[model samples]
Target: MSNVILMIFTGLSVGAVYFLLGSGLALIFGLMRVLTFAHGAYLTACAYAGWFILRHSSLAAGPSIGTLLLALLVGVVVGGALAFLTERVLLRALYQRDHLDQLLVTAGLGFSLVALLNGIWGPDSRAVPTPPWFTRTTTDIFGAHIARGDFVLIGVAVLLLIALEAFLKHTRHGLVVRAGVENREMVRALGIDVRRSFTLIFTVGGAVAGLGGVLAALYANAVNTTIGDTYLLYAFIVLVVGGLGSLRGAAIAALAVGLLQQFANFYVNPGLGEILSFILMGAMLLLRPEGVGGKKIRLI
Candidate 1:
């Protein structure tokens, strides 16, 4: 019983990480109508940027909250700036072109950037520095030994989720974003320069990816070149199951997949969780193409 509880909590934290990655993908795909293959590169780069700050800066002597916050800030800024540039330069050229062309270009960018990261950072994982108070220590919870870090990740995810929901449902900018997702043509026809929204959307998406990258490193206790790649695939599955424009769906799908994978891996086999997740994605594609939320971002 304790084991089950532990797994659930662990799964929630894992799911929190997934949500961080997926939510960004969702927002980008939701508004831009472009599958952001370059997003993985954004994550990987920002993560490395943050890691470099922490591992090499003055704060490297010891764990400090300043180190943590600075790394996160750098990641977010770099991510957002990279995304803004990509949208203004690379993406704009392919706007009128075929989506396959867009995909190919972005995928190439993603691959090339990752390769650069490998060359620069080397193909190995580096331990992430945490605060002195921070450790992968386990605490008792209802007879379950839960990692303290799990609570941190889960709490952060939850807070971000609330902030996002409020932003989308209340803010004027967010309303434009939702409207753009629902009907880009209509939004444009209404005399709103949706192009501005496009850049904002991309920036927001990239910022989310950046935040996820930092948090992911902290969660895993390390940073690696391929860390974002592993999560990007799962995040795509999340988009498929949750729908392209639904944060609510992304959250639910993330948690479900996280829990399912953890439980299956523990009880059944080590890698079966990933296999099962893919299977679930296939099932969802065939049975509910509109997604679990029954929301479809019209392709037009």
Candidate 2:
């Protein structure tokens, strides 16, 4: 039972990362109708950025809450900037194009971004030591050792989820974005700048992805050139399994995937464990094309 509880915590932590990454991808795809292959690239960039800050700055592993907060803030800003540029330079042009063209263009952009990241950060693995405050000690929970970092990640995920929900439900800017999603033509007719809403959505998505990167870098204790690649597929799977544009769906789907993956890894071979995630995703796709959550438009 203790082991099971431990696994659940671990799964939740991993799911938090997936939720963060997938939420962003889903938002971009849902609002802009652009399949952004560059999402992973943004995550990779953020990981590298966080790594650089931790290595060079006065930040030390463990309980440096202030430093972690600053790192996350930097991630949001940098990620937002990157998203804005990508939208302006690439996605904006492909908005009216066919899905195939958008796919190819975004795929190419992703490749370009990957190459750019490699050029700047090299292919070597870089360590991202946890803050001194976060690394203090592990707590025994039902005989399972839980790290403070894991709890922190889960807490952050919950807080972010709540915050996003509130923003989307109550905020004026969020209402505009939702309105645009439902009826771009109507939004434009109302003299609301739909494009601006798209840009905001993209920027917010990027920031979420960056937060995932930060959590991943700290959790893994290392960041590498291909780290983003590792989670990209999982993010897509989560997005698909969850309904597009549905934040609640994404969160629930992420938790399911995380727990499923953990169970597979524990009971099955690691290679097979990875395969199980796809199998489950495939089943979900076949049985329910709309995803686990039914699709509903908040706007007209």
Candidate 3:
């Protein structure tokens, strides 16, 4: 029983990061209607940024909670900046083009970004330095041993999810975003400055991805140039299962996928775990067609 609990907790811990990444992708797709291939790049870059800062800076001696927080701040800022640049310089040019053009451009850009990362960080994997506090802390529950950091990761994800839901449902800016997702033309008709909203949403999405990168890196005790690619693939699966625009669905699907993957990996072949995830996704598509929380809408 304790082993089962541990496996479930492990699944939830990993799923929280996927939820963060998938929710960002869903937001960008739902609102901007553009498939951002560069998102994974953003995540990788931020992880690298955090890794670099923590390793090279004064914090390298013995990182504390404050040091980790600073690294996180750096990661998020870099992610947002990169997203801003991508939006202003690259994505803006394709707003009027069809989805195919946008996808091609972003895909090309993603490959280029990956190459850039390889060139800069090299092909070797790097580890994120966890603060001593995180490593030293542990708790026991029902005969199961758990790391405080794992719980921290789960807590952060849950809080962020709740805050985002509140923001979208309660705040004026979030309401505008939700409305824009539904009808960009209608929002523009109301003089809501839809373009600015687009920029904001895209930047926020990037920031969320960056946060995920940092958290995942800490959990894995490593980062690599290909980290983004791995997570990006999983993010798409989560988005597909959750529905394109539904944050709630992303959260639930992320947990489901994480649990499924972990359980399969433990009881079956590691390769089979990923295969099971895909099978689940295929079944969901055949049954729901529109996704778990997705509404039928014409993709423009």
Candidate 4:
């Protein structure tokens, strides 16, 4: 029973990160109709940025709370800036192009980002150690040992999810974004600045990805050039399983995936965990191509 509880907590933490990352991808796809292959690159870049800050800054060995906060902030700023630049310079040119063209452009951008990361960070595995407080702290509940880091991650995820829901449902900017998603031409016809809304959504999406990256780095205690690739497939799986353009779907899908993966890892081989996740996703796709909570989409 204690083991089950521990697994549940751990799964929730991981699920939260997946939710954020998958949500960003889904939002971009729904709003822009562009499949961004560069999203994984952005996530990798954020991870590296967090690793760099932790290695070189004075906060590397301080209280875990402060260090984690600082790293998350840095990740958000850097990721958001990168997204803004990419949209303005590259994505803007492909906005009116066909899906094939957009895919090719984004794929090229992703390759270029990989090359750039290699040049800067080299091909080495780097670890982001948990701070002193986190390393030493543990709580016993129902005869199970729970790390403080897990609690912190779950808390942050809950807060961010609520905030994102409120932003989309209650804010004017969010309404414009939703409008653009539904009918870009109609939004423009109504004298709204659709471009600005796109930019805002892109930035926000990037920030969310960055936050996920930071949490991943802290939890795994390692950052490498291929870290993005590791999570990219999983993020896409979550997006597909959750439904496109639906935050609620993404959240629910993430939790389901996380818990499923965690229990599979515990009862089965860890190496096969990803394979199992893929299998689950594939089954969902075959049975409900529209996703668990998405409207039916026609494929060309």
Candidate 5:
């Protein structure tokens, strides 16, 4: 029972990061119709940024809660800035073009960003330095030790879910974003600036991804150039299963995927976690019964 509890926490911890990526991807594709390949790059860059702050900066001597907060803030800012540039400079012109063109452009940008990361940080993994509190388990329940870091990931993800839901459902800006997703031209005709909403949503997606990147490093106990790549595809699976433009689904699916992967890997084969996740995704697609192209612009 204790072993099982530990696995559950571990799975939830992994899923929390995936939720950040999945939710961000769903929100972006939901509103902008742009499946950003560069999102993983955002995660990677932000992780690097966070790592530098925590390890190479003035805080490196005696990192604490304040240091962690600062690192997370830097990561979020970096992610937002990168996303703003992508939306304004590269994606704005191609929104009206064929989806293939947009896909190619984003894909190319993602590759370039990865190359830049490799150039700056090199290909080696950097050790993530955590505060002592993070490593110390708060308590051992039935011999299942629960680390403080796990709670941090889980809590942040839950809070983010609530905040975004409130933002989209309650505020005027949320209304604009929802309307913009449904029909940008109609919103534009109403004299609402849908482009700003586009940029806003995209920036939010990037910002969330950036936050995830830092938390992910903390979760894994290390950082690497390919850290974002590690979670990117699985997150897309979560996005697809949850449905595009649906934060509700993404939230639920993230927990489900994370739990499934963790349990499967432990009780079954060592690498069966991802295989089972794909099976779950397939099951979801079968139930939806949508055409491939339709799925691209699908809101559900």
Candidate 6:
């Protein structure tokens, strides 16, 4: 029973990471209808940036809450800035183009960024230093041994999910963004600047991806060049299963995949967990092509 609980906790933690990454991808897809291949690079960049700050700055010699928060802040800011720049420079021209053009351009940018990362960080993986509070293996809470980081991740995920849903449903900016997502022409008709709306959405997506990168690095204790590509694939699957533009679906689907993957890894084999994820994705695609809450939209 304890083992089962442990797996569930671990799975939820992993799912939190996936949710953060997938939420950003889903947001971009929902609003911009752009399959943002460059998003992976954004994640990688934030991870590296945060890691570098933590390792090289005056905070390098010690682990403290200030260092942790500052590192995450650096990651989020850098990620948002990178995404904003990419949209303004590389992607603005292609917004009106076909999906093929968007894909090609973003994919090219992703590859370029990956190459750039190699040049700058080299091929070696980098580890993030967490605060002393997070390093403990377990904390005694009501007589149950639980991993400190796992439940923290889950709690963070839950809070983020609620905050996001509330923001989209309640706030004026959120309503405008949602309106833009449903109909840009109508939004423009209302005198809202659709381009600016898109910029805001893209920037938010980048921030979410950045947060996920920081969490993943902390959880795994390392970040590498290929992390973006690898997690991007997983994010795609999660988005497909959860439905595009649906945060609730993403949350549910993330937990499902995370649980399944963890269970398979424990009961079956390590590699088999990845295989199972794809198998689940394939089944979802076959049985419900539109995904859980996703509407059917033509992807050309």
For model 2, where is the 10-residue window of minimal lDDT?
A: 291-300
CA lDDT, every model vs. true structure: 0.84, 0.81, 0.82, 0.80, 0.86, 0.82
TM-score of 4: 0.93
**Which pairs in model 5 have colliding backbones?**
none
Stronger candidate by lDDT (1 vs 2): 1
lDDT of 6 at 245: 85
TM-score, structure 1 vs. true: 0.93
Candidate 4 to native Cα RMSD, angstroms:
1.9
Score every model by TM-score.
Answer: 0.93, 0.93, 0.94, 0.93, 0.94, 0.94
Stretches of candidate 2 off by over 4 Å are: 58-63, 296-300
C-alpha positional error of residue 176 in candidate 4 after TM-score superposition, expressed in Å:
1.0
Better-scoring candidate (TM-score), 2 or 3: 3
Q: Please, what are the lDDT tens digits per residue for candidate 6 over residues 95-207?
A: 87888888888899889988999998898987777766675778654444676778777887898889878977897778888888778888899899878868887888888
Better of 2 and 6 by lDDT: 6
Worst 10 residues of 6 by lDDT: 139-148
lDDT of 1 by residue, 14-82 (tens): 889888889888888865688779888888998898888877764537757788889889999998998
Q: Model 1, poorest ten-residue lDDT window?
A: 130-139
Say what the RMSD of model 5 is: 2.6
Q: Residue 107 lDDT in model 1?
A: 91
Where does the lowest 10-residue lDDT sum fall in candidate 5?
291-300
Candidate 3 segments exceeding 4 Å error: 57-60, 296-300
Expressed as tens digits, the lDDT of each residue in 103-219 for candidate 2 is 777678778887898898789887786676575548677788777877887898888889888988898778998888778899889888888878888998999988888889988
lDDT of 4 at 52: 77
Error of 1 at 265 (Å): 0.8
Q: Which residue ranges in model 6 land beyond 4 Å of their true spot?
A: 57-60, 140-144
